[model samples]
Target chain A: DAMVIQNPRYQVTQFGKPVTLSCSQTLNHNVMYWYQQKSSQAPKLLFHYYDKDFNNEADTPDNFQSRRPNTSFCFLDIRSPGLGDAAMYLCATSRDLGLETQYFGPGTRLLVL
Target chain B: GESVGLHLPTLSVQEGDNSIINCAYSNSASDYFIWYKQESGKGPQFIIDIRSNMDKRQGQRVTVLLNKTVKHLSLQIAATQPGDSAVYFCAENEDTGFQKLVFGTGTRLLVSP
Candidate 1:
């Protein structure tokens, strides 16, 4: 089945170290999104790519960045991991059709020591 | 501009019972709405959706109701099962430019057997 896939379902990184999470999709969607979800809170939008165009949320920290290398793969990078950055990272994709629904990958849970 | 939100933080229901989750949005311009279910250690999965033109839409065992006038949305689950226990969220999006979806703080649904 065509679906979204994430690598390294669980990630551990030392404080101030860099970590990268990857997402791949077989659905051939036009938009890919990255979200950070902490315990008991909403999944906050970090950034998204409309093809190669990147759109970052106003409140997203500079420590977080994303890249869509091509149509099927996207990567989320944390330049310097902090303890507060430990959370679930979600990746999603949707078609360009105006009313299309998004498909999400199993998230990568990051832990910063 | 869509400010999607949910009314409750948590809900408890018995297996085989019906469950209702409610949400409210601030943007009337949002033309598309979706409900998602997220299990522990997993990503949010699309459950159902309703358009602004329609008040209700049904899926296999889920239904979404949209009340544009009151800016309210609700999801109904029939014959709820243990596997249905998860955090549920509602998201809204506009039909025009920048198809960014705004999601609400989720409601944790506990289905007890």
Candidate 2:
């Protein structure tokens, strides 16, 4: 099945350290999204890439950044991880034209110490 | 600020019973809504969706109701099982703008045997 895939299903980082999470999709969807979800909380959209065009949320912190090198690959970067930054990083992909169902990866759980 | 929210944070249901989860959105322009289920160590899986033009839509064992007037949405799960125990989130997509789906805080459903 064509699906979204995330690297490092579990991530551990120290405070003030930089970390990167990667996502790649075989679906070839034009829109790729990165979301941060805490325990039992909603997955908050940090940003998304629409066919190489990046859109960041207004309230998304400066510490968080995303890059999509191509249609199939995207990366989320945390400049300086904090204890509070520990959460599950989810990667999703959807078609470009209209509202389409999003496909999600297994997610990367980041533990910042 | 545009946001999607849930009415309850948790719900308890017995096995083989039905489950209902409620959500509210502040964006009237949101035309598309979706329900997602997330397991403990996995990413969210799409359950069903409803458009603003329609009041309801249903899938296997799942139904979604949209009340555009009150900006409310609900998800109903029939014949719930222990495997149905997870966090449910309602998401909305703005019809006019970027069309990104905004997720609610989520409601945890506990299925007791």
Which regions of candidate 1 are displaced past 4 Å? B1-8, B94-96
lDDT tens readout by residue for model 1, B1-113: 32234444789999999999999876789989999999988999988888899999989999889999899999999999999999998998864467568887788999999
Question: In CAPRI terms, where does candidate 1 land?
Answer: medium
Chain B TM-score for the candidates in order = 0.90, 0.90
Cα lDDT, model 2, residue A12: 94
Best by TM-score: 1
**What is candidate 1's fraction of native contacts?**
0.53
DockQ of each: 0.49, 0.49
Off by over 4 Å in 2: B1-8
Candidate 2 lDDT tens digits, A1-113: 89999999999999999999999999989999999887766888889888978889988999999988888899999999999999999999998846777878999999998
Q: lDDT of model 2 at residue A44?
A: 84
